[model samples]
Target chain A: MTYCVGLRMKRGLVFMSDTRTNAGVDNISTFRKMHTWCVPGERLVTLMTAGNLATTQAVISVLEERSKAQGERNPSILEQPSMFQVARLVGETLREVISERSTQGQAADSAFGATIIVGGQIDPGPPRLFLIYPEGNFIEASEDTPFFQIGETKYGRPMLLRGFSEDLTFPDAIKLLLVSFDSTLKANLSVGMPFDLQTYVADSFEIGHEDRITRDNPYYNEISEGWGRALREALGQLPPYDMG
Target chain B: MTYCVGLRMKRGLVFMSDTRTNAGVDNISTFRKMHTWCVPGERLVTLMTAGNLATTQAVISVLEERSKAQGERNPSILEQPSMFQVARLVGETLREVISERSTQGQAADSAFGATIIVGGQIDPGPPRLFLIYPEGNFIEASEDTPFFQIGETKYGRPMLLRGFSEDLTFPDAIKLLLVSFDSTLKANLSVGMPFDLQTYVADSFEIGHEDRITRDNPYYNEISEGWGRALREALGQLPPYDMG
Candidate 1:
């Protein structure tokens, strides 16, 4: 299971992904599911992926391999003309990855899904967010759905949906995400600790934050503590049940 | 679809369940999901159920029918000495309901899952919580897994896992549950408005606190507001991403 969220806020874009993966509960492992492509001030694109590991990595490898071609014109992340183009390229790349994996040799290997969040800014425009569906197509973020959550999203989504309002600062977005993630982590054994977090301020022409939070990360710990304490405090504040 | 949770805490037991039941997206109806048959001060018992309405109603019908019998000696709930026995009786009732439905001969449908939460204190012991499964079996709540959630539980399960501590006041428990349900309601279209909530103090020996929370419930509004405010505050406090 995976829990990755991309928030496209008035301030900028925030991306976070859990580092746990389990193939049946017994075979659990940590694998980074985020991919970053940076051309400094030119374009900063990041993708947080969820679903089949092999499929996701293969998609990333396709993009990476494209950037390394020696002779002909290669359409690479660095070469994409715009953020929209970058998303299109990603969809095309993922489509190819799944197609290549389809084979008669693989018996009973049927339905597949790989959802990805593409968010970033080119030096020219505001940071943007897109939800690339399993079908190799995507949708951009809008006022109605300002955020996209992939993998184990149901548990923590309400916080993002109802809590997210316009004019929300980058920081508020991050905090909402932590509680959402905190909620998800506690409920799901599949989504474990040590999260990969990245936040980019819109039009800053660079990523403002990037960190991997383990159980010991101070800020992460603080938010978790404050949330629990606040919850208790909130509970105390509620009018007592008139069961007496 | 419904959301029901049973928690066993030092202060006693808390049970809450949403009443909305829908067979599909279009046909939504409200049927009470909670039922209580208490001997009052001498014995207090509450039964909260979720899944397959027919099956659940059937189980309740059987139990109620037996309780009303003038002289029956077959391990009825009224005759049970311990809350554990009552749990078994509920589990057995569920098994019987499913079995009767299956024996009607339609290729043995696997469409039967009616789990019940039975919590109460008999004449003399600590109040306990039990989750009755479909197979005429049950599991009691313990310290490590202090709560049992049945039916549409995954979404809200995370919030409780993170926020639940034995020290949390019953109000806090209720607050946490409302937020959890809020998350579930937003993410899943099947679960909806107007929630049924009930909270019990350990040895009070009666259904003391109960409320029907509709769209206009004041406390419900406060919880949703406070939750959003806290998330935004938490986000503001996170260190800005420094992705170079």
Candidate 2:
């Protein structure tokens, strides 16, 4: 299992993902699930994936290979004209990978499935965020739903639903995602640290900031401990149930 | 879908369950998923169920009818020697119902399965909680896991993990449960209002209190609103992320 989130705020987009992957309880391993592609000032795209590691890695490998090619031998995410087209290219590539695996005798729906969150900006348009399904279809984030979470989503969703706003500042947005991720990490063992986090400031057409938050990161520790204490304090403050 | 929780505390046991049942989004209905059986001064047992409504209802109905029968025509929960035995009875009954449905050509695992949380106290024994599965097996909640939640569980679990304690007061336990339930309700359309809440005080050998909290309940409204405000305020108080 995995937990990845992409938030599309008015100022920019925020992407965060956990690094733990497991084929089973005994075969746990660390793998980076966040991938980035950039043409510098022309375009910047970030992809976060969850599900079968082999399938997601294959899809990423295909995209990476295409991006490094010199000419039009194959269309690459770098060559996409808009964020929407970039999402389409990623979705199609993911479908092709899963299809190949299926033809090799693996079940498409269960064994080779993966979900992707694509967010970035191309020179011609505003930044966008999309959640691409295993079947190669996708949905864009809207004002009503400014965030998309894939993988072990439910444990952390309440915090997002309660705290998210379209106009949140970058700092506040990251804090919100941290709280959400903290909740998931505490409740589920499959979603472990360190987390990969990246932010794209609006209209920059470049990555704003990126960091890998490990268990020893002081700031991450502070957020985790502080949020836990604050939640307990808040529960303490709620009016006691009336037994009458 | 449903969300029901049972908490075992030093002072007593707390049980809360949402009443919504659905066969899909369009076929939603309200049905009590919490049932209680009491021998007044002898014992008090509460069962909260989740999963297929037909299987759960059949299990509960059979228990209810047997309890009302005279002259020991059949063994009933009233005749159980201990809360553990009561759980075993419930588990066996659930398994029997599913097996009967399976013999009628339904797939027992998928279509006729039900999960139950049973908590109560009988004379000469301490209060206990057990989670009964469809296969007639059960596990008791221990100090490590003081609460059990069935159905739509993930969204609300973090709160319980953070707030629960073996020594919580009855009122505090109920408050924690309401917070958990509120989170589930906000994130899921399938689990909705009017909740059944019951508390059993230690050594009382009978229910301490019970209430049906509906949408118009004022205290419920206060807790819901206050929790939302508290969470947002806590988020605001967290130190802002440094971009360095």
Candidate 3:
């Protein structure tokens, strides 16, 4: 299981994902789920994946191999004219990988399927964010729905719904994402730490900032403990039930 | 859809359930999900249901009918000597109803299945809580697992995990439950007010307190708004992420 979130705001976009993957309770390993491709001064594309590790890895490898190769025969993420085209390329790649795996007798919608969140900016166009389904279809984020979450999303959704705003600063958005991820990590064993975070400022055409937060990181620890204490204090302050 | 929770604490037990049931977004109505049967000084049992409305209503109707009828052939919940026995009786009744419906060609494990949370006190035994599955098997809550939630559970679970304590007072427990339900209500359209809440005090062998909290209830509104403000304030106080 995995938990990844992509937020599109007036100022920029923020992406965060956990690194834990498990086949069962006894078989668990750490793997990065955030992949980024950048052509400085031209475009920056970020992809976060959830679901079958094999499918996600295959999709990423195919894109990376093509991007490094020299030819128009194989479309590369770096060559996409706009963020919309980048999303289309990623969705097509995901569908191809899943279809190939299905021919080997694996169910298409079973554990072999994967979902991806694509967000980036291309020169001469505005920044964009999309959630690509396993079937090669995708939907872009809008004002009413300015965020996308994949895998184990419910546990962390209330915070995002209540805290997200179009005008939030980059620091505030990252803080909100950390709180959201902390809640998920505590409630579910499947989502764990060493989180990968990246931010893109609107119209920058470059990756603004990035970091990997581990369990021992002071800021992450502060948010975890501080949020717990704050919740308890908040509960205490609420008016008690009338019980009459 | 429905949302119900049962918490077992050192002082007593707390049970809360939303009254909304819907076949789909357009077909929604309010129906109480919390049922109580009390023979004061002997036994007090509270049952909360989630899943197929038909299955749950049938199980409750059967239990109520048998308890009032003059029959020694069928064991009624009122005749159970221990809380554990009460849980077993409810689980068996749920399984019977599901099987009966299945003989009519309905799939037993489909949307027709129902899950129940049974909690209460019987004379000579401590208060207890059990989560009865659709398959006639049930598991009791213990120190490690002190609560059980059914239907749309993920949105509200983090609050329960962070606020619950074995020694919480009845008032504190109710407050915690209200916060949990408020989160679910805001995040889901399927789960809504008015909520039914009940508490049982150990050794009393009688219901302690009960209330039906509606949307216009002042205390409910206070908790809902207070929690949202507290969360935002908490997010602001957390150490900002060091985006390097």
Candidate 4:
């Protein structure tokens, strides 16, 4: 299981993902799920994956190799004219990886499936966000839906639904994402600490504040502990039910 | 999908369940899922069901018939001397209904499986709570685990885990449960409104407050709207994340 979310705010886009990966309850390891590619002033791309680890890693490796100067570069994500094309390339790469694994008769196609969230700015195009499915099709975030979440999403969704706004600032967006992640971490063991966070500003063509939040991060601890008390007090403030 | 919960507090037991049942997204109907059988001063039992509606209704029908004075009363739940025996009878009845459906070759065994939460008190016994599985096995709720929820449970669980306390009053417990249910209702279309609620006080040997909360129920409306503001305020009160 994994938890990853990308929010498209008025300021820009903010992405956060947990690093824990597990084959089963007995076997667990940490692997970064967020990958980034930036050509400084030209473009900035961020991708977060959730699902079969092998499939995601293969797709990432293929994208990385194609972007290299000495290798095949015809279909490189970095060279795509628009964020839409970059999303298409990533989707096709994910589909290709899954089909390749299944053709070897290693496992069923569904066993190698993965979902992805790819978003960022490409030159003159405005910053955009998309949730790419295992089938290789994708949908962009819009006014009605300003965010995307994949893997272990339910526990953290209510807060996100109620709190998101177009006028949110970079700091508040990060705070919201942390609260969502904190709820998930406390409820499920599969999603662990050492979170990767990256923010992008509209038209900046460069990544904004980025950090790796560790288990003992002072701010993370404060939010986790303080939110509980806040919720209790909030509950107390509601008028008592008239059980007449 | 459904949502039903039975919570045990020092004051006694509280139960709530949504009434929406569906064969598919297009076919949905409201059906009461909370069933109660009480002998007034002798015993009080409340059972909440989730899963195959047919199996649950059959089990409830059988229990009701046996409890009638005009029919077989030998193994009736009202005659049970202890809450444990009542739990065992309910579990066995559930298993019987499921196997009977499958033996007729109607469908797979799992298609008729149902899970139940039955808890109350009989003469000479303290209030107790039990969660019964489809296999005719059951587990009692202890101090460490004082609540049982079935169907569409994840969306509403984090709040229950954080809010439940042995020393909680009935009003506070109901408030917590309403907040939990409101979260589930908003997140899932399959779990709809007109919720049924029942509460039992320890050693009373009879049901206490019982109410059917409809969509326009003023207090529910208040809680649902108030919770959004309360949560937003709570988030604002938490120390802002330092994106340094």
Candidate 5:
């Protein structure tokens, strides 16, 4: 299990993902799930993956190998003309990897499936966000859906639904994501720290602040503990359930 | 699908269950999932179920019939010697119904499976809570595990973990449950109002406050709307995230 969120904000795109992956409870390992591609001022593509680790790794490796060879025959996600095309490339790559794995007859098709959140800018186009399914289909984030979360999402979702807004500042958005992750971490052992985070300011065609938030990260610790106290206080603020 | 929680506090036990039941999104109906069998001054037992509605209903019907008959061989849950025995009776009945359904060759064995949370006090014994699994096995809630939630549980669990405490008053416990259920209701269409609530005060051997909280219930509306506001305010109370 994993937890990753790609949030589309008014000013930019924010992405966060947990590094922990497990085949089973006893067999757990830390693996970075966020992959980034950039052509400096030309394009920036960020993807956070959740689901089968093998399939995600294969997709990323394919994209990386293609990007290394500069040709139209095997275009990299970095070479895509727009964010939409970039998303399509990622989805197709993911589906291809899963299809190859399932064709090997080692496991069921669903066992090799993965989901992805892809977001970035391609020159003139605005910063866009998309959730790419294992079936090679995708949906873009819009006014109604401003964020996409994959894997172990439910525990962390209520906070996002209540707190996220279009005009949120980068720092505030990070804070919100940390709070959401904190809720998920507390509830599920499968999703653990340290979390990978990235921010991309719209139209900059460049990545913004990037950090690896570990358990010892002072800000995360503060938010985790402070949120609990704040929640109790918040509960107190509600009118008492008067049996009268 | 359903959402039911049985919370154990210092005062007694608090149980709440959503009334919504659906075979599919297109075929939805409301049915009570919380049932109580109390021998007033002798014992008070409450059972809240989640999973296959048919299996749960059949188990309840069998128990109802047995309780109506007076015999040693046909022992009813009400005739149980202790709260533990009552849980055993519920578990056996659940397994029996599921087994019968599967043997009829109608569907898979798991399709008829259901889980239950049963708690109460029988004379000379303290209040006890048990989570009965489909396989006729059960585990009691103790100091470490003070609550049990069945079906569509993840979205609402964080609140219970953060808010529940042994010393919590009945009103506060009910408030905490309402908040938890509100989160689930907001996140899932399978679980909806009106919610049924019942509280049993430990030695009284009688059910305490019982109420059916409807959508238009002022208190629920207040908590639902207030909780969102309170959560946002709580998030604001945290120190600002500084990228410095």
Candidate 6:
């Protein structure tokens, strides 16, 4: 289990994911959920996945394999003209891996379910984000829905409900996400850190602003303590319920 | 789909549920998810359910029927001596109904996956909360884990994380729940409006302050707006991500 969020805002695209995975309670391990594919000045794509690690790894392996194939028309994400096409290629790969594994009787359902949040710019259009399903279908982000989440998404919905907006600054987005993630982490053990976060400033097809946010990350610690205090203060501020 | 939460706090107990039932996106209707059995100052038990509507309705109907039966040796919720016994009765009722319906083979295993949050006091004992699973087994809430959520639980976890505390006032608990429910409503269309909320003070067993909270409720409106503003303010307070 994991928690990952992709935001497509006016300034750029933001992708964040936790680095925790578990086969069961005893086999818990920290595995980064975010992966990047960049072509320097031409394109920069970030993919974050949730579900069975083997299945997601297989999907990514296939994409990397097809991309390096000698003049093959396998429709690698690097060669896709648009984010939509990239999503299609990712979905197709997910479907392919799932079908192959299911043939060997793995019961490829939610235990083996895989979904990806794909976000980046393709040189021609503005930054975009997509949530590609296990079935090889997907939905793109819109002004009405500026963010997409996968894995342990519900634990963080309340904060996103009121925090996400098209006009949000990249910093505000990251902070809102931190508070959201803190809330999720307290309630659910599946989504832990260190977090993998990357911000793409629309036309800046560079990949330097990536950070491996650990528990000791200074700003993160501030937000966690501040948000907890603020919440208790807020609760104290509300008018008491009078049942008389 | 449904959303229900039960809290066990020093102040007392709070139980709330949304009344929306849906088979799919198209088939949706309003049906109360709360059931109450009271004996003035003797025993007061409240049960809130989530999962297959048919299965829940069946369990409730059986409980209601058993409550009205006279001189029957078969144990039922109303006849139970302790709140723990009441939870056991609800679980047994749920398991019975599920076994009966499952024999018909109309639905899958998730159909029997109905969950109930049972809480209240029986005469001398303090107020307590228990979460009963479909198998008729249940777990009691403690100081370390003072709440239980069912149905569409994920979207509300963060809000509860931020807002919930053993020290919170009952009114604050209600407010926290509204924000949590609001988050859930915004994220999942399956859980919807006209919620049912009931709060019971420790010794004030006879007076169950249950209300049919609709979209027009003033306090509800305040919670939704206040939460939105509070989130924005909190996010605005975070330091901007220094992409230096």
lDDT of each: 0.79, 0.91, 0.89, 0.90, 0.91, 0.83
Which stretches of model 2 miss by more than 4 angstroms?
A66-75, A106-109, B66-75, B106-110
- The residue-by-residue lDDT of candidate 4 on A51-148, one tens digit each, is 99998999998998845676555437778999999999999999898888878865553488899999999999999999999889899999999999
Evaluate model 2 with DockQ and give the value.
0.86
For candidate 1, the TM-score of chain A alone relative to the native chain A: 0.90
Clashing pairs in 6: A154-B154
- List, residue by residue over A140-242, the lDDT tens digit for candidate 3: 9999999999999988998898888989988889989988899899888999889999999988888888898999998888888988898888777777766
Please give, as one word, the docking class of candidate 1.
acceptable
Model 6 agreement with the true structure over A107-181: per-residue lDDT tens digits:
644556799999998888778899999888899999778899898887777778677887888778888888878
Position A82, candidate 4: lDDT: 97
Winner on lDDT between 1 and 6 is 6
Tens-digit lDDT string for candidate 2 (A1-244): 9999999998999999999999778889999999998878888999999999998998988887755656644537878889999899999999998888888864445678999999999998999999999999999999899999999999999999999998999889999999999999998899999999999998898888999999998988899999988999999889999897
**Minimal lDDT window, size 10, model 3 chain A:** A66-75
**What is the TM-score of each predicted model, taking all chains together?**
0.85, 0.96, 0.94, 0.95, 0.96, 0.91
TM-score of chain B of each: 0.92, 0.94, 0.94, 0.95, 0.95, 0.93
In candidate 3 chain B, where is summed lDDT lowest over 10 consecutive residues?
Answer: B66-75
Model 2 residue B179 CA deviation in Å: 1.1
For model 5 the local lDDT of residue B225 reads: 97
The TM-score measured for candidate 3 stands at: 0.94
lDDT of 3 at B109: 54
Error of 2 at B189 (Å): 0.8
Better of 5 and 6 by DockQ: 5
lDDT of 3 by residue, B1-244 (tens): 7899999999888999999999879999999999998989988999999989999999998888755657643437888989888888899999999888888874545657999999998888888899999998999999999999999999999889989999888888888988888889988999989999888888888888888899998888888898889778777777777665
